[model samples]
Target: MLREIYLSTALLAAFGLVGAGLVALVHMGTAERIEANREAATLARLHEILPDGEYDNDIINDTTVLSHALLGGGQHLVYRARRNDEPVAAVFTVIARGGYSGDIHLLVGVRENGQVAGVRVISHRETPGLGDDIEASRSDWILGFDNLALDDPPMERWAVQRDGGIFDQFTGATITPRAVVRAVRDTLIYFDTHREQVFTPIPVDPTDEEAHADE
Candidate 1:
């Protein structure tokens, strides 16, 4: 009986180790491809936001922080677009949490002058026909936010058409579109307010160097 228990335990351990090894091998093989795909996608989105010229990579601080200008949700990735060593605009990922089903990720570009250059939906799990209209494929409604400035007597001009503003919401899907509009508006406002801080260079901490060395 003792011998049988020992054999059973050994087999379970061996199986567990094999499973872990397979998972590790798969991850190791796929890591590069996954990273390449991510980089390509990021560059494509950055180009859409800043179509004029090339941009160099700029890192934000270590702490993941969201902008208050975000309306429906928050800011994710922030990149500073540059031309001739001068910062032209800051592109950041914004999310709209009030989508028909859930959060809708959006890539937003705000110029130094506080105008929205462009926006693109990165990903979402919204309903097929109804909420999908937020995508560029279903409709060109999302493109309407391009070149909108945050000036004038009031920024209320950026609201949805149903709210007596410039943008138009989907026929039946008002909440999804409305949330996106608000998010874009808020992002622009946040950019205008935190222009200096966002454009500043991120300082590298010495502790990070030690951590990397340990790795």
Candidate 2:
């Protein structure tokens, strides 16, 4: 009976190892294709928010990820679009955590001049009817942010009407809209202050160049 038990255990271990190897092989084979699909979808969203003919550079190739307060204190991707090697616009994703139900993810486009080109809610877990209006398809409230700037609405006036600002809150959801408004404001401010840094090209390392040459 003991020998039979050992044999069963060995068989189970071998099967587990084989399953893991197959999973790894599948992952390795599909990784690049999956990444390509993801990148394409991201670029589609980026172009949707940016104004037509605003940029000609390969925004996907000129991307950077940073962990900062404006981006919900987590890693966020920032895409830079340029025309003739000159900066034209920036698209980035940010999160608003004060939603009615949970955090809201937003994609924001800002022109080189600091004005917002457009904003879109990538995903959110806010109340179904109230917070869902933040989406462009459901309501036009998000359109109000187009062409907005820091001083146009004024930093102090970046709240909903109940708080004496210009934006309108949903019929039953004040917290959601207010949180979104503040998030856009913060994202704009972050880009405005970091404009030079954002547009700066990353310097190639000399050591890496030598290593590549050796290879």
* Maximum-lDDT candidate: 2
- Candidate with the greatest TM-score versus the true structure: 2
Q: All candidates: CA RMSD in angstroms?
A: 4.7, 3.9
> How would you encode candidate 1's per-residue C-alpha lDDT over 92-112 as one tens digit per residue?
778877777888888888887
* lDDT to native, each model: 0.75, 0.88
Q: Which regions of candidate 1 deviate over 4 angstroms?
A: 1-27, 52-75, 152-154, 204-215
Which stretch of 10 consecutive residues in model 2 shows the poorest summed lDDT? 47-56
For candidate 1, the TM-score is 0.74
